[model samples]
Target chain A: MKTLVYVAHDNVHLGDATLATVTAASKLGEVHLLVAGAGCGAVAEAASRIAGIGKVHVADDAACEHQLAENIAPLIAGLMTDHDAVLFPATTTGKNIAPRVAALLDVMQISDILSVEGERTFTRPIYAGNAIATVESSDAKLVITVRGTAFDKAEAEGGAAEIAAVASTDDAGKSSFVSAELAKSERPELTSAKIIVSGGRALKDSATFENIVMPLADKLGAGVGASRAAVDAGYVPNDYQVGQTGKIVAPEVYIAIGISGAIQHLAGMKDSKTIIAINKDEDAPIFQVADIGLVADLYQAVPELTAAL
Target chain B: MKALVPVKRVIDYNVKPRVKADGSGVDLANVKMSMNPFDEIAVEEAVRLKEAGQIDEIVVVSIGPAKAQETLRAALAMGADSALLIETEEAIEPLAVAKMLKAVSGEVEPGLIILGKQAIDDDSNQTGQMLAGLMNLPQGTFASKVELEGDHVRVTREVDGGLETVRLSTPAIITTDLRLNEPRYASLPNIMKAKKKPLEIKTPADYGVDIAPRLKTLNVSEPPVRQAGVKVADVDELIARLKAMGVA
Candidate 1:
């Protein structure tokens, strides 16, 4: 099988660049890495070192700068004819782009791939993430969205192949590039954060919100987060949101404060390693998923917890 | 302007989902079903737009079993002019749902299509974007505020970054994030009015949509159990532990 991996410098590059190599070595295939833009020469170089990659394909164009879906989707569909299977790192960009590419191919698209059980199989979450489901798509030309964080990145090894120019569109130019604001934080991103601190609507007012959420995050050196209600209430920014409508976070320790643990919010943080919930309501939905539950006011508990840590 | 909203029957948000002993899936035999929470928000947003005179009408749709009409009523009660159910027992993927709606969008020629970011049960947040892709329209996902500007729509949304505002041409797709709006309870009068409202039932085959399972599910399993950790005796102990772990 020839596996073509579509990678972006911002979202797809990881410590080991494993998505480029994992199925590459595991399954006998020709691996082609599509470094979507420039400055990811490092990522392409990393892909070449992986044992299974047959060639490194760089779709370099000034329009490829941001990998806007319109330009990349058609290009990937065009690339679909060359490969038996296509994989993309299951980032936000991956979630949107892979399926469209598959739809164009009239094939199956598997999302949030945990592991490849076989050449045409994977495990993913379902039902607001209360359970993990193993899935298989036997379609000839398969498109898969791989959770990049799940696989071990391969160490850099070999020579990088020459760059190739694939036809890309100015569709990104057609669509308005509205203002973009990245959530600036020294802490790791919620999706990839090892430790996460989440506050529920119990924070009461926006004035108490940062005090309730930020201190706990600071104490634990964790990324700060909020339940959908808290985010919706404008107590916290959307980037800090952890839930079904927001981010799916799988971290080592996820400390949820004042959160009611709605099913939607649980779906996002349920995959955490160490789950702790601090809420005034003992019966809050979050308690069901937490390893530790403290039925107390988050206001009193959070400050003391922060000071203690 | 016109609006399109999608509602799905899901296990009530408050119910605790049980993993079946066979691990086939969660049992929904006797579970109370309700309109998916986010879809209710979509309906609420559309209804609000109508009340504000921004949108002239709303057409709500659902793609599920026959019982889905019950879910559709919840939308009608919220002030949708009419409802459509593309009945199917087969669990439909988001992409196929999008394709069906793309056809519906052409028929109705709605100015905007509103949807829940994902149905809580299936939890696939793909349909809105796929519909936009299939229809070749601009999409403003997880919208917080959807405003009308003459012939175009200005959608304010919470992106992976901070809030972003996008201006798109007519026929845009806007998905509801939780914070979009608080759904209003259907009043007793409105509930009575909903029964008299029209509901058009169609089949997936009628829509020329083959609702096939693109990704086949093999098994369902519990995530690895997390071991309990002791509470630190003091701040100093917590600091020491952090230092030992190099997290400090």
Candidate 2:
């Protein structure tokens, strides 16, 4: 099977999610990466080095700098003439663009697939990960978005693939970028972080949450996350949320502090390799999935743990 | 200007879905159904826009079973002027739903279309984007904040790294995210008033859209349960356990 994998990038650096997506696409057959952005030759060069890639198609155009769906979807659809399946990393950008391509291709899209069971069958989480459904598509062409955490990351370097330039498409003139207010953090990104230290509403306010959670995360060199309750309570930005409605993470270790894990919260991080929960309440549901449970007041234990570490 | 909001009735977010023993799909028998939480935010945003006088009329739509009128009425209680229900007993995918909404849009010709990012049941975040694609309209998806300025709408979108703002002309699409707004409950008086609101029911055939299943579900099952591990006595033991596990 021939596949087209849209490279997840920000017009400068390649996103780690694309590595996992490349791994997922490799499961089907040869993987051809598509890098579409203004002056994104470096991203294309980086993608060509991924071990299993067959080729990298670069669409360097000003119209795609922001990766707007209006321009990118049509570009992808036009390239689908030679490919049987197209895979996108299920990021906000991918989710916004893939469905449009599917509509342009006159096919249905399978969103956030957890596994590629066969050429046309895959498993995905539904009802906030409560149920898993294995679905098969009868469409002649397939459009899919791969959940990054579900698959192992492909090797970043090792192989050399040909980089080809494709003609750029015209601007759709429907939407225009105004500004961006991305959160600037010194720590790693949540999805790609090896270790994550997440707090909940028990942290009280934003100041206290930052004071308590940041030091531990800094000490461990880990990414910071928060439960939806904490995010809703205005303790942190919405980007820090780690739950079913938020970001799904599967890190080497996940530390839950004062978090009474709701089902939605657990759905995001239950796949972590090791989970440690420190909540004063012994009956908190987070303990049900935690690998190591510590029943203690986070106010005291967290400080002590941070200092000790 | 008129605003169009599409909502879905699904199992209440508070309830856990149960997969049938036969592995066909989720068991919805005797399940408590409510407007999808994200769609509630959409309806709330539309009502707030109308109250602010930016919108003259708000028309809500739902493509589901006959019972979906209840969902539409709930939107009406939240201050929609009227509602349209594309009634169907068959399971309609997002692509078909987008097609039917496209047909409805041809008649409504609303200035703005608002939708929930994804329904919690199917968790397929596709319909709104697909609708925008089919109609060749600009889209501001996963919007946290929306503001109207003359003929253009500015939206603050929730993206992977952080927030992005974009400007789209009138007759655009906006999908609500979790942080958009807190939805208000329908009061008794408004619920009574909603009963008198105009509701029109149509079928997929009226739209000339085929609601066929492009994807077939082979089986549905629960995810593997994570086994609970032992509790540590203190922070030192927890640290030691982590060290032993090679993850500290």
Candidate 3:
């Protein structure tokens, strides 16, 4: 089986999600990496060096910049003619594009696959990770999105695969990139962060959310996250939300500050290696899953913890 | 203009699904069922559009067992003009659902199609995109904010890094994200009115689509459980333990 893996990126560097997707794709057969972006030669070069990849297919064009799904989906669909299976990283970009590709090919897409049972069989979590379903597809072609946390990141440097260019396709003019307001942060990305420090609704406001959570996160060099309640309260952007409906993170160390840990919030980070909860509520649901639970006022404990660290 | 919205009936989000002892699937025999949370958002968005007079009609469609009619009625109570139930017992896949929606879209010629980004039960997140592809329509997915302009729609999407705004022409597809809107509960009066709303029941064959189970379930099992560890006395001890565990 020949598999084409869509490398999720930002036209600069390949994210850890791509490496994990490559690892999942390798389970199928020979893997080829597809990088779609403008002036992304370095990303393609990086992709070619990943172990187990047979080739790196680059589609460098202005239209592909920012990976407008309208443009990238067609470029991917046109290339799917040669590959038996297509895999994506299950990031926002992948989720946005893979379905369009499946629609174009008249195929069903298997998403957030947790385990690959066979060439066409996969296990995926449903109901926000509460239930797991094993499905086998008989579609002639397979389009899949792999959850990054489920697989280990493939070695970044090893093999040297040949780099080739994929032809540019016509832009549908259906959708165009208006603008983006990305968070500028020095800490690691949430999904790939080694440590995450998240706040809940108890943070009160955005200023407090930053004043309390960001300091600890910065002290530990951890990614910052918020509970759905915090995000809904306008404490942070939606991207910072870590829950069943938001981004799922499984960092090595996860600290929940002032979080009551609803089941939805737990679903996203319960797999962390070491879970710590700092909340005034002694019986917060978060403590049940927390490896180290601390019952205290987050206002005092968080600052003290940050200062000590 | 007409807005077509697809709602899925699934186990309520609050229910923790239990895998059957036989390993066939999640136990849904007596589970509390409701419209998928994301689909509820989609229905709410469409209803808001209709109320805003941006769209003249809002059509809600569901594909499932006879019980799916309840899901459609719920949408109607929320102000959808009518309901379509593609009744089926066979487990339907995303591709088949997209095909059926495409057929419905062709017949309805809706100005816009709204759907949940994914159904919580399957969590495939593919139907809206697949439907967009089948109909050769533009798609704005994972939308948190949707605004209709004269001839196009502007959507704000919650992406990995932050938010991204996109503009798409009319006759587009927009999938609902979590922050799309707070769905309103159906009042008793609206529920009564929904009982009189038009509901057309059809099958996949009526739309020339096959509702076959494309995927086979090998087994259903739970994820590896994480054991509860020792609780620290204070923040100092918590840090000490984390350091000892080499996690911090």
Model 2's chain A TM-score stands at 0.99
Q: Score the docking of each candidate (DockQ).
A: 0.40, 0.88, 0.74
The number of clashing residue pairs in model 2 is 0
**CA displacement after TM-score superposition, residue B193 of candidate 2 (Å):** 0.8
- Per-residue accuracy of model 3 over A205-243 as CA lDDT, tens digit each: 999998999989988889999999999999998889998
Candidate number with greatest DockQ: 2
Estimate every model's Cα lDDT from 0 to 1: 0.74, 0.94, 0.89
Chain A TM-score of candidate 3 vs. true chain A: 0.97
Candidate with top lDDT is 2
Q: lDDT tens digits, residues B112-221, model 2?
A: 99999999999999999999999999999999999999899999999988899999988999999988898999999999999999999999999999898999999999
**What does the interface RMSD come to for each candidate?**
3.4, 0.7, 1.4
TM-score of every candidate relative to the true structure: 0.86, 0.99, 0.97
Per-model chain B TM-scores are 0.94, 0.99, 0.97
Question: By the lDDT metric, which is better: model 2 or model 3?
Answer: 2
What ranking of all candidate models by DockQ puts the best one first?
Answer: 2, 3, 1
In order, the candidates keep a fraction of the true contacts of: 0.42, 0.87, 0.81
Candidate 3 docking quality: incorrect, acceptable, medium or high: medium
